[model samples]
Target: MSPLLLVVAAAGGVGAGLRYLVDRLVTPAAGARFPVGILIVNVSGSFALGVLTGLGAAVAPELSLALGAGLLGGYTTFSTVSVETVLLAERRRWRDAALNLFGTLALTAVAAGLGLLLGSAAA
Candidate 1:
């Protein structure tokens, strides 16, 4: 494998481990219905990805790919969020489902944009 690919592979493992750790730590407090774990990771991932993108011009392409495409990509859980939302709706928790869907969308967008601005300023 290419050196860059190896780096991304390692980063992906790290990201996945971190995701699991964060979920384990936060899920109980987030409650069983809300799925705040996925929400947190997705938003955080978006922010991290935004920072990488904002620093794209100033940073190495390989570093960006490893963290953005590999790390954050693994850390984020869109599929799980979708499944959880669907399950919530199926279980008649319409409010929680809607909140999860809209909340994740709104928060992640804001986080990404904020990260971009901050990262650009820092760069």
Candidate 2:
């Protein structure tokens, strides 16, 4: 495999592990009504996504992927996000579940796009 691919692969594994650890640490306090894990991951991921994009824009193009994709890729947990939403909906927590589902999709897209725009603009 290409070395870049290998780097991404390694980043993915590390990101997944860190995400799991973070969820375990934060979920209990977040409570049953609110999916603290999804919220934490989503919001923090948003902030980090913004920072990564801003940094890339103000610094270098390469910084975007290295930080955005490498760091944020692992930091952000889509699977968990999906599962949370599904479980919520299944359990009849329509409000919370919908928020997780639609909110994440809309926000993450905007964040990534903004990041890319910022990164490219910086370049």
Model 1: lDDT of residue 46: 92
* Candidate number of the best TM-score: 1
Candidate 2: residue pairs that collide: none
Model 1 misplacement above 4 A: none
The ten-residue window of minimal lDDT in model 1 covers: 30-39
Q: Would you estimate the TM-scores of all the predictions?
A: 0.94, 0.71
- Clash count list over all predictions: 0, 0
Q: What is the alpha-carbon lDDT of model 2 when measured against the actual structure?
A: 0.72
> Compared with the true structure, what per-residue lDDT tens digits does model 1 show for residues 1-123?
799998898888998999999988899986775787888899999998888888767988877888887888889988988999999999999998999999999999999999899889889
| Tens-place lDDT digits, model 2, residues 1-123 | 777666766776776777777777887877667667666666667666775655644656555565567766887877778888889889999998988888888877776677556656565
Residue 70 of model 1, lDDT score:
83
TM-score of 1: 0.94
